[model samples]
Target chain A: MTERASFREYHQNIIERVATRLEESLPAQWQIPSSLREAMLYSLMAGGKRMRPLLVMAACEALDGNADAALDAACAVEMVHTYSLIHDDLPAMDNDDYRRGKLTNHKVFGEAAAILAGDALLTHAFYLVARLSQVHGVPAEQVVNITMDLAELAGPKGMVGGQAADMEGEQGLTELSQLEYIHLHKTSDLITFSLLAGGRIAGADEQKLEALRTFGQKLGLAFQIQDDILDIVGDEAKLGKKTQSDMKQEKVTYPYFIGLEASRGEVERLTAEAKSAVIEAGLADPSRLLEIADYLMNRDH
Target chain B: MTERASFREYHQNIIERVATRLEESLPAQWQIPSSLREAMLYSLMAGGKRMRPLLVMAACEALDGNADAALDAACAVEMVHTYSLIHDDLPAMDNDDYRRGKLTNHKVFGEAAAILAGDALLTHAFYLVARLSQVHGVPAEQVVNITMDLAELAGPKGMVGGQAADMEGEQGLTELSQLEYIHLHKTSDLITFSLLAGGRIAGADEQKLEALRTFGQKLGLAFQIQDDILDIVGDEAKLGKKTQSDMKQEKVTYPYFIGLEASRGEVERLTAEAKSAVIEAGLADPSRLLEIADYLMNRDH
Candidate 1:
């Protein structure tokens, strides 16, 4: 099998393990504010590929930290990602009616409830992070650093900036650089934070962490490009999200700017740079991260 | 002048100090996501009464912490409050068009920027907390504790819950207890956090902090009641916000259930309880706090 196929299987297995653990960590459904808890779980457990958290785990493991030690950090990052998706799909934003082939949170739970659910999830994300420092027996400094990075990435300088830029694009932007601006904020920043945070949790030093950041940076761009490619080529049923919505909305995308083929080439190039950086970090074991970098570009859904 | 009017002047002074400090801390305009920054500043600096932060400062002073050291905490709480107001006024939410006698954030900055500004302000609130720990020479553990408290107040079980309940009330809540439920989540929780976090910064002992929590609980309820009364009797120009909109919306308020006179009495009773707590804390100077609490019921706004 190609490196991409085998890596997909490996990531799939790890993500399932993490997801199961997350479910166990939550306050029992009954203890939660029934309707609000349901909305959080519905979006949280609906199960994306768990890419961000998986990055956190893989980076920690690569950096010689116990993957389990970073579990809550991993979960928190995923939770933040989930909350953004929930809010982003609200009628006032993307007005998305569906996500992951299921009705959007706002669609099922009403706009106010969905918005509150998103706020709750985001808040819970930090709660988990704070709790993790206590439970994982890590340095408070590490927890603080990890939390700060997560907050910044999930906040204005990162994903929120991207979302704003993306929203602006719906009004039709004339510049291709603006498309890149959107991608950097919307996708690349958090992906970069995910890997670096995992390393920090493991006590990875500055030099090593720097290399891993370069790796994550390239990987995120590749991943977003791959997303554009998938929307063009992958099966809608399998992907479980709407296809051609970008085109339909006249939203800017790599595919729209560079054409599908050029975007395809960019992903391939980014994948190579990403893999090389991981190899340079000397942080990975048994070629798994290198393999995963290859696989990120190959994800079809 | 009555003791209450005397106290109002004290609250007004504290309000001015906070406003001056916050505006001075900010560049006339910060360029990082300039539009969102503008939105946050517009809402936060738009002539707010500074009641929450004053409570925080007062509680800190009562416990032997310098009110100056509490600046970041004070500002952080206000930012969170402002973020909520911005979101609460969104087209997808309450959709009101005015705040503090000016256009709401969404009305001024466009909906997407408004949403983003709210998210940024919320995130920045935490950012400020983390930085405050350093700037104020607060112990790391104390800083972490305050951060956690701030997060909780803003999160699912606290302010967000209040917002959710408020939303549900629009669909019509039949039970008076449900309206209290709304107040607890929406108003009381943040108020509680405001006072509690202030004490935490000051290193208040458990007994004193707990007492202030009691004070805050009463004050929060009274504060909301006063707000309800203001909606009925407040002059629009004096309130610096739209005054007549709430009753027109047919939404519930404390006066809507208990009648205006009862709500006024409740505010007076609660304000007295709050003052007693400050005195009980046994601070070197309880004058400022006493002044603020004594005047709680008399604001035309």
Candidate 2:
């Protein structure tokens, strides 16, 4: 219980730090048109668990690197994630009315404004990274490499490709291999990138980088399977969303093909694999990463 | 007559080169899902004037920089331009049926695919810039600066801000200042970035950079005003689109406030100012830039 409490505190610390940075990163309202600023700030400040930024900060901390150096990147990843969520929830996409228990960007701002807000956020993410590279005095080579990794990972071959596949899959039958591809690219890719980016920023050596990459990939898969399980079993009120949405959407998920028990087992196995990779890499204080993995595997929401 | 024909030939050469490079810059079909790739390539390769890329090349050439070095940047700019066009033509935005005489992206592909394509292209543009920085062994610092410039110019404070203003202006009374703000940001900002990016790649002196900046602003305004004029008077077949779109949409345009003759006069004055800025910068062979400006001023299609 004590360990769990401490882990929660640690997670809270990272989240708070990231939240402050995010608020600071946005331009002043006076600097931009009121409506655009409001729309952008609306979704930006809507506040999720901020998992991506936490990964960045944690990765930096694990490597004994400067957490400050990772702040812009941390905020940048969150912006990208937020923008993806906005677009994904558009009338043309998932068409969700609520996200994080609040109205989606388009629900309040209208379709055009929502789309522009997403674009602004995405474009602003890179801008923030570039600006921070200068402000933090990080090497441009490192920043550019990081930027490339981000763009490629989030691009057509990565997240966008997965999304396109998912959309196409909806109109037809989906295979397990296809579902895995979708999971890997759509969700796992960005998660892996978040961790990899953190490790990269910390100047982790190649072996360490490889270990983080492996850990991230395993953890991401495990996380998604847990989500699949949650969709089936999670409390609607607690989760702040409808349960079994995938079933309603006819979206293929892990539990749909494999049994619920088997999906849970898969999550356990993947979580163990992630922890082992972290230990094998000999990351400084793997405790936090392990705790996060455990928390993800056990998370009800 | 001979000089005019040769100048036309020179512009055509740049346009052709840019078009080819734009094709090559996209990820191969194998790299991404065919549907996503097709959607992205469909708009990217859609034949247009390739003005932004040409500006990058011309600016680089004027500074005696290696054109090859700017090729990636040139292609990058076009990707940005294409992505903007895709989003701008969305039903939520302009709702245009045709662009470059072909069906808009959303018309051919579904809205979801179109949105994803634009997102993918925007992400891919940065990816290309990062890759080019490595492939060409350019200094990371320079690339980071360039990236920063691109992001800011295209992001909220620049292009996105302009778009937001344009959308907001549609609902309320628009003042001349508001219209200028929209035009400067929505259209001129990216154009300026293209030229400035070229100059930066060539390591131009501050004076030269300023000159390019000034030239770009003037040229962009002239180009937009000319577009306004064309929308009023251009032949449908030659323009490859229906004219009077601004009037139909009730978009605030230069010819709407200023008389048609005055708008034409503004284009002429701005074109001359652009040319003079180029010459004053002592750029080598200002002929192409001047010719481009004149072409923009005189173009009916």
DockQ, candidate no. 1: 0.43
The lowest-lDDT stretch of 10 consecutive residues in candidate 1 chain B is B24-33
Best by lDDT: 2
Which regions of candidate 1 deviate over 4 angstroms?
A1-10, A21-33, A174-176, A284-286, B1-17, B20-31, B66-69, B241-246
lDDT per residue (tens digit) for residues A258-281 in model 1:
899999899889888888877876
Pairs with steric clashes in candidate 2:
none
Q: Put down candidate 2 lDDT per residue, B164-192, tens digits, no spaces.
A: 99899998645777887888888888899
- In candidate 1, which residue pairs clash? B162-B185, B162-B186
> How do the residues B1-301 of candidate 1 rate in per-residue lDDT, one tens digit apiece?
3444455565777788788776654445432455555666788888777778888887787677867768677887888888899989888789889877788888888876887778777776776676665577777666667767776777776788778767767877777788887787688878888888888888877887777787887778877888888888888778877776778888877787778888788889888888787678666666766666656666676
Winning candidate number (TM-score):
2
DockQ of 2: 0.77
What lDDT score is found at residue B183 in candidate 2? 80
List candidate 2 stretches off by more than 4 Å.
A1-5, B1-5
